[model samples]
Target: MDATSFILPLAEITIAGAIINASVHFVPVGGAPAAMATSTGVGTGTTQLAAGAGFTGLLAAATMASQAGVSLANPVHMLLIMLSGAVGAMIMLGLTMLIGQIIYVYGIGIVPAADKCEKDPITGDIQKPYITPGTTGHGIPTVCFVSGSIGAALGGLGGALAYIALQQLGFAAAIAGVLAVGFFFMNAVLASYNIGGTIEGFHDPKFKKMPNGVIASFVSSLIAGAVLIGMAMGL
Candidate 1:
């Protein structure tokens, strides 16, 4: 009912949105082409991949936060909750990339390559020579894997922040979770649209468009946060 109550969560939601959007840009999404070994990264959209990992992290954080003696009001406890989310998300994305890499390398028999750069930014391996003549690239390279994991971590942290803000507004765990999921998807989709199609990771030229996505998410989340505050007032 007070301005402080409304403003705090609103600010948190806005910042979380921006973080989620930026995180999506760090992920390497190769889309349908990647499924067939014609491009780099996991064979999915940025939104899907980010959301998947984010939700998993959210679940982990919620589990930790809900435990007896855990106090969200304590900064250390809050940090631990957020860190749990980040670690959970990283593990989810790591396993996902690992499995995809296995299939890409062993099942499809394609060498890991990135078309965006002449050489692997991390491994320093020649990229172009390994890529198939007709394809942009193939398989999950080391840089892409690292970038995706970083993105997943950010996504988890963002999701946890949103949930914590909602919980602070006095919403029940279930309601706060649903709201957080919706909030995460809204920002994730915005980032995906900004990507326009595909991205290879942080090193990809498409990463430069991240600001556009972050701005869009920030504005959208502000509106969503207002609606949430109105709902909280009723509750």
Candidate 2:
């Protein structure tokens, strides 16, 4: 049946969440600069999602309003488009979450557990291995930030389309998706090179040896995209 009622809320929430994340990344929560001021940005891209989502939402709204002039069509038409948007947004969100999970649990997160010591020596086997930025390369955070933004855009745009579809018909939904994706795509290019050094404090002597941040981002995005596609089906 594709009811417009439930789908509207789902679409809005997903879009809003992504936008908020985008906003946070760019808005700079504290008085200081976002990433560079920090010890190291790591997964700091989550903060920026808010702004991206907000802008995307506004664009979607304008689109739906304009198309209203076209015709007073069937509610079912609106519902179907809304369903598509919902499906798309869910796909994007699921992907980002999956990537986030991977980053959190593996790579930077998978610190070796300190319980495998066998010999009962005087020093007690030092247990956990430390992760100094010195051990990693510059590309790690860079990759993560880039990947996160891609995931956010995919999710947010899907959400924006959902919003328009909920209110109106075909053209509006398409417009919403286009606007959201376009703005985000432009931003993606910029975020790729800039985020790592600024957010994760990549330049800090400690992280000087850390791995490249770019690879992490690319891989994360891949995992996220796959998961999002799976989620879209459910939506």
Candidate 3:
């Protein structure tokens, strides 16, 4: 293989890592608080939510790419694969938020509210009044749902791109899938650490630290890509 082959795939891997890191910042995570209707977002950690959605997307993209006559070299096919990933991720996260919303509203008897902002940026709904005393917020608000959806899409895209880069580097399907999952987790964890704790999606103050995570993921990904390339050469 030529220098271009190595360089291009390496670049894709690096960008995908950065994008995955950025995507995590957009997801709303309320941790233990949301589980008890004390805070906003889904009752989960960032890495788990992101990994679940990202893996779904990765599976969808891989399935699409593996179809007969599908060529990764073809731009149209590539776009379709990426779209498949994004849609898969969106569906998974969307349903999760929806179901969580149902439980929060009907089961837990708490209103969906965002404490990070007085007004939702997407729906322009007032947020402050719905919140309970001594609690951050309750349930996944409209803004958080929207933000999570966007994050899922980006996560899917990043996972798909990383898988594509691995395939381009000549790894088999099984190898590529395993490597992609590891790659996804690495970046996701980096972003999660940057967050430091629960966050209320993009509207939260924690989102401001996204750039730091992205930069870290980029550097880490570059190193990982180099190692993968070396492995490919050996193969």
Q: Assess each prediction's global lDDT (C-alpha) against the native.
A: 0.91, 0.36, 0.95
Candidate 1 residue-wise lDDT, 1-235, digit = tens? 6878678888988899999999999898999999999999899988899999999989988998899998878889888888988999999999999999999999989999999999889989999999999999999999999999999999999999998889988899998999899999999999999999999999999999999999999999999888889899994
lDDT of 2: 0.36
List candidate 1 segments past 4 Å from native.
none
The TM-score between candidate 3 and the true structure equals 0.98
Collision pairs in model 1? none
Model 3 residue pairs with clashes:
none
The lDDT ranking, best first, is: 3, 1, 2
Tens-digit lDDT track of model 2 for 111-221: 311121221122343322433333322112332343334443443444444345333322344544553454334333333333443332222232332233233333443
lDDT of 3 at 33: 82
By TM-score rank, best first, the candidates go: 3, 1, 2
**Higher-ranked by TM-score: 2 or 3:** 3
Give the Å shift of residue 115 in candidate 1.
Answer: 0.8
- Between prediction 1 and prediction 2, the one with superior lDDT is 1
Residue 118 lDDT in candidate 3: 92
Alpha-carbon shift of residue 4 in model 2 (angstroms): 22
Q: How far off is residue 110 in model 3, in Å?
A: 0.8
